[model samples]
Target: MAARKKWYSQGLRFSCTGCGYCCSGRPGYVYVNDEEIAQISQYLGLETAEFLSRFTRETHRERSLNERPNGDCVFLDPISRSCRIYPLRPRQCRTFPFWNSNLRRPRDWEDVCRTCPGCGKGPVFSYETIEELRRVIDL
Candidate 1:
């Protein structure tokens, strides 16, 4: 059977402009698993336990990166507005704008593009690529 066409079936453009808009001004989860915690800890030269204590918080029995009082991600540098642990960032962080919540419908994608400058600004991601990314983190 042929698959139904989605609003973004033609593909979507996205290239992180690094404005940090997505990283701040909103309180949301950047959920990380045990393996991600370990990698981020090693990248920062901190012990796993120390990293978890200082950078993560538990809510609803799941672990996620901490956010600043004003709602910026803890790893978001106040000055540069870039992630401190970009390379080892969790899978959730790696998949941005491609999240299911954002791609579920055209309206959702429109909402995301409003805040995320990266959306509609760069390479065109085919539906196949977008679907693959959406599967990476069940967001």
Candidate 2:
């Protein structure tokens, strides 16, 4: 009989080297759920309504954080590629290669992996960590 395959058994790995490449330039759309919105708004010392109005845009009934004119995320500090609201960043940012349906495809990761220095090699996190990330993002 064949051994069962784990979710991430493909041996994919990554560690944020702080390159900020992911946060730079035009960051793609980042979805924000109600809980994430509340957490981030509270972290910024604002009411949810105010934060939503000032920092977010509505699209087809979903909410997304506003991006800069250049398309980078508003919370992304261009110079540092670091999140201004790191403590309150949405679960999407925290999960990276483990979030949503994107990373499920190995081929899809290649384009991103090619540009990120930390893609193919980095510190190995335990399976527990990956599972935790999944939980945080509600994946």
User: Weakest 10 consecutive residues, lDDT, candidate 2?
Assistant: 99-108
Q: Report the CA-based lDDT of candidate 1 relative to the real structure.
A: 0.90
- Tell me the deviation in Å of residue 48 in model 1: 0.7
Candidate 2: residue 39 Cα off by (Å): 1.9
Question: For every model shown, what is its TM-score relative to the native structure?
Answer: 0.96, 0.79
> lDDT values of the candidates?
0.90, 0.76
Query: After TM-score superposition, what is the CA distance of residue 89 in candidate 1 from its true location, in Å?
Result: 1.0
* RMSD of each candidate relative to the true structure: 1.0, 2.8
> What is candidate 1's TM-score against the reference?
0.96
Model 1, span 6-106: residue lDDT tens: 89999999999889887889798889999998889999999999999999999885899999999999999999999889988888878888999999889
Q: Which stretches of candidate 1 lie over 4 Å from their true place?
A: none
Model 2: lDDT of residue 138: 44
